[model samples]
Target: MDANDFVEIDGSYLEGGGQALRNALSLSCILGKPVRVVKIRANRPNPGLSHQHLHGLDLLRDITNADVVGNVLLSTKVEFTPRTILDNTYRVDTRTAASITLIYQMALPVLLFAGRSSRLIVSGGTNVAFAPPVEYMQQVLLPNLKRFGAGFELKVQQYGFYPRGKGTCQLDVQPVAKLNAGQFMDFGRINLVSGVGFCAGRLPVNIAIDMQQTAQREIHRLWPEQECTIETVKHSPEKTRDNGAGILMTANTTGGVVLGASALGKKRIDGHVLGSEASCQLAEYMRKEICVDDYMQDQLIIYMALAVGRSRMRTGRLTKHTRTAIHVAEQMTGVKFDVTVEPGGQTLVTCEGLGQLNKLI
Candidate 1:
């Protein structure tokens, strides 16, 4: 399928929410494919684009000079056709404090595909609900992507939490001619694993201290020899409306595989629970004996499609989000996908017809 062939997606098909829509839109922009989305998150309370979604859409429109028509509202369907993206530093501001990570997710793929390097400065919520915190991006995703020859730098100028969203981050991206595939089948030996707790806003300093102490003790119990650290940041009264905390754990493998897990603060949240949950999540990934996480599985599909060679990954589960991503990818590149479900609930995803698909796209 070339850029001329229009594709249609039932946005409410699976997971039945904005994520489906976001994935569809992002693929359209990255591949310069035109897409028509129907049943647009039909089950959602406010089914269409929220301010964050619209902001992401607007940023794409500005970057690719795409032709978009339809209501940029909650649950509304949209048709987008990306022309060619421009290469330069772009600035985007999400008026409402939406998750900046969502914006980064949508735009990063397109920027990577751009003919020239690009830089971006975005202002808005950096730490928000239902999204990866800034720490996750800096510590986990970006570093892992570097293994595949992806290189980018992110600088957080401020911490933005919920309600009162005022934060800033700058990104520098250097596009690569082609990506190198890597493997992570075994976690090797556990070198070090630790947890960090960060708190902001009206949060009491004692809360951060208590959470850190609790998390550190749990980490010590799990790996007695591992080292840990905790930190807290207090926000000026004028900068925040509420309290927030984030817990992150990083595990180093003997063979150099670095895996990260994280949990965020919520009302009545227990620090021990947060630490244990993050630790367990990392352990589960290691147990799966796979190289990629569920999130990376979905994120890397597009890169695999664009790569010059075959790429494969073994993941814990094929979530609806993963399925949606694969569907969108096939539509964009017309590359037939081979997905096998293992007996123990793991999934093997592979793409072999890359050379031919690259010609088509």
Candidate 2:
């Protein structure tokens, strides 16, 4: 490879977290640009690739036919050179409780621009800490991504929890030529709220119902006139690898606005409290003038750079993760993000997309 063939990204920049490496690899795979990132996750307590990060990297390498160096757990640096994007069914198992959602999120973009459609059967934790659950991915992210003319279907085969995680899910994606700009700037009235509360393994099914009941009552307290509903999913031990419980809640507006929040049950945490917090968080998000939630804003920044026209997203606050995503996208592709904060406390992020084409297609 020539000296200038690939760009070196400092993983310690801005957020200095796993997202930098994930976004860098995703962009590298899509744009077919080689990348070398050093000091991966330099600021975290465990400042290197863990099982979770390694799982995503290996998948990226395989799908893009990339020559990757320093691919291992605890690796602090990586060099990736992608030759092409190939469509195929891949089975990836983290074996541990590493988040499958994180892996799917990073891989979806690369697969979206592949020469053909792809299918993934991934195993790991579905509802984990510090990552989006499968429910949120299905209910929130997928619908939001549809605005850009790219979509996928995810079906969970089994619920995976922490510790002895080996949960499974399937993702089916179809390749598309170009993505349209998404303008999610209008905040609307939320008339309906829905949620799924689930428990798997040794936990009792009623605990899941309790989580649902608590969340529903809390949301009703906030908006008495609104319609709120929650359902419980009882997963047998045969359907799960270990014991776990969690709730995923979403608020939908009559004007096409959707906001989601989730809470994972922990050994020390109370499910009722978790449920209350999830509902309260959704309510708090609605109170803001912003249309996009924090996590969705972080994820959408990448697509904004890849779309055809000027993509815009209005959000209330900017996270370091979002800023790092912008930096990585700008460095990897020929796109710039313009962020304008209005007096109403809403920040509009606008980007003139690269409208990248999959040459293989």
Candidate 3:
């Protein structure tokens, strides 16, 4: 498929969630291919375009100069056509203070494909419910990306959590020609694996400390010599959020992958419960020889699509989100994605022949 082809997506397929919309917008930008999304999140309660989704679309619009129509609250269809490729240094203001990480996810794919070096100043909620907060991106995701030859630094200028969303984060990225495909089947020697939780905005230092202590004890019992820490931040009067915490697990290896699990609840904060839950999730993934988890799978898809040769990874399951991503990829580039599940409940995904796509730039 060329840039001119108009791809169509049926949003009511599975759960009809925001993942469908996000995948479509991301692929549209990456392939410079226009798409029309229909029945968008038809089953969602307050579906279609929430603040985060709108912010994501706005970011894509600014970077790709795309023509977007039928983009409003709860709209069922959207038509997007890119006018140009992404460039450097774009700013997106999610006036509603939705999760900036979601916006970054939508924009990062395009920037990595077309940008030489890019700087982003996103203003919105840094710590929001049901989204990966700045802490997760800084500790878990960014470190894993470094292994693939992508490097970026994030500096939080302010704090924004939940309803009173007013925060800012600056991103600086140095692009790479191609990400190297390497094996992470085994976490070599298990040098370091620890969880850190950060609390901000009306949250007390003891909350952070308790959560850290709980996680440290749990993790040390499972794997001795792992280090853990907690950080607390005071909020401004304008930022009226109760409390927030995010847990990140970093396992260092020759080829390392970080697994993150987070929970953000209002009023009710259980430090030990949160710590144990995050640690248990990481432990489950660590038991597997394959790097298979929801976040890691999605993040690796972009890198695999851009790799020069064949690249493969064993994942937990081929979720609707994963299938939706693969569908959008084929629609945009006419490249088939092959995903297979083995008897051991490991899923293997392989992408080939991206060398030609690399030369197009």
Identify the leading candidate in terms of lDDT.
Answer: 2
lDDT of candidate 1 over 1-361, digit per residue (tens): 3544778888777676666667777778766678887777677677777888788888888888988877466637788888877778998887567888888888886777677778888878887777877787887778677766787889887777677677888888776666666444555777766556666766676655666676667666765776766554455555455567777777677765667777877776566676666666766776665667765676677666666667777677787777877776776677867888889777788875344221112
Candidate 1 whole-model C-alpha lDDT, 0 to 1: 0.72
Candidate 1: which pairs clash? Answer: 47-74, 47-75, 48-74, 48-75, 49-73, 49-74
| Candidate 3 residue 323 C-alpha distance from true site, Å | 2.6
**Predictions in order: lDDT:** 0.72, 0.88, 0.69
Q: Candidate 2's residue-wise lDDT over 1-361, tens digit each?
A: 8858779899999899898999999999988789999999999999899999998999999998889999988999999999888999999999988899999988999999988889999999888888999999999999899989999999989888877778899999998888889888877778778998888777788888788888888877877888888989888767874778888898887667788989998886466887887888888887784678888988998899999999888887799999999998899886999999888888999999998876767
Candidate 3 residues 42-124, lDDT tens each?
A: 88887687877877787788778989987787778888987665567888777765888878777765666664677888888
Off by over 4 Å in 1: 1-4, 224-242, 343-345, 353-361
Q: What is the model-wide C-alpha lDDT for candidate 2? A: 0.88
Candidates arranged by lDDT, highest first: 2, 1, 3
**TM per prediction:** 0.87, 0.97, 0.87
Q: Report the alpha-carbon TM-score of model 2 versus the true structure.
A: 0.97
Question: Candidate 2: where are CA atoms >4 Å away?
Answer: none
Error (Å) of candidate 3 at residue 295 is 1.9
Q: Best candidate per TM-score, number? A: 2
